[model samples]
Target: MAVINNDSSVFQRIPNELANSIFDFLPNRDIKNLRLICRYLDRHVPLRFNRVFISANPLDVKVFLAIANHDTFRKQVKELIWDATLQSPRSCGNDSDDDYGSDEDSSDDNDYQGQSRFQRGCREAIEDAESRLVDKADGNEQQSLLDNLMTSGRALSYYERLVEEQADVLETRADEEAV
Candidate 1:
């Protein structure tokens, strides 16, 4: 049997329709790894890892802000997952002035109730501190801080705007096809 050597590249020989069909069957992690194999794959693989989880924790907020500011990454993002659970520091159970109950008469149930109340208080304190920091910040910083606070609604709005923009692009492409 004679060896067949096609002048065209393997990827070029495969139709984009077939490539997309194959890509659909692959898991997201595999797809991401496949994208690194060649420029064509890199460009053709639509963003499957689209969800961006943003928690109330400061570090996660920082990451969310970074993604929001990035033009290309932000457009690829489809969902903004918000986790609003407050992350409080572990208490030592020492008799500090901030302690909710006196150590003398605190039973197990009362201790649990007190801890719950303390957690709520901690959450409120964090919000108050953040507000104070925002107030002290200069014009741009203040705006950024406010944006971080409103990120849940703002992220949704941003995603909606992106969808609208994509729709417009599709419409323009369709018009070109018609012509």
Candidate 2:
């Protein structure tokens, strides 16, 4: 019969390679929290999160910039997954066109049209609020906001071009990898 000592840490018992293998299965948030636990974990956890997500949000961009500025953290980054649709729910304003239905009942048609118009109004209101916020921002704040916006726009454009050129090959590779 084999006896195991409970006094010593389980992590200490496990080999470093095995520990790293386990860490690879953890979510990014869990790995980040684990990094805060100890110096050893801090050294390893950042490397596990190689792919960083940069969204259209200002805070996400700031986080990306911080990571980029750090020498150790920057070296750990392997890929950046940019989410351009973070700000708006729908990428385009074609929801109204999709809502059109061939209904004989006038009331039903009226209701559909009313709902479509309401959605459009809501979208416009959001855009207006965003523009107002930008306009009311101070010089430095406005410039920062503009910089973030430009960065997001550039990323989106780059992604679009990549998709246009290599979408089929990328999709096939992704599908093959998934299988």
Task: Give lDDT tens digits, candidate 1, residues 45-137.
Answer: 765647887643444555666677877777877887766444343355652455454433433211122334343444455457666875464
* lDDT tens digits by residue: candidate 2, 71-131: 8888888898865452222245644565544323333111222334333453445446567
Task: Please give the distance, in angstroms, between residue 144's alpha carbon in candidate 2 and its true position after superposition.
Answer: 36
The number of clashing residue pairs in model 1 is 0
The lDDT, on a scale of 0 to 1, for candidate 1 is: 0.54
* Cα lDDT computed for each candidate against the true fold: 0.54, 0.53
Model 2 spans > 4 angstroms off: 1-8, 29-44, 86-179
TM-score for each of the candidates: 0.37, 0.36
TM-score of 2: 0.36
What's model 2's lDDT at 139?
65
Quote the positional error of residue 111 for candidate 2 in Å: 22
All-Cα superposition RMSD per candidate: 18.7, 16.0
Identify the runs in model 1 with alpha carbons over 4 angstroms from their true place. 1-9, 66-78, 94-179
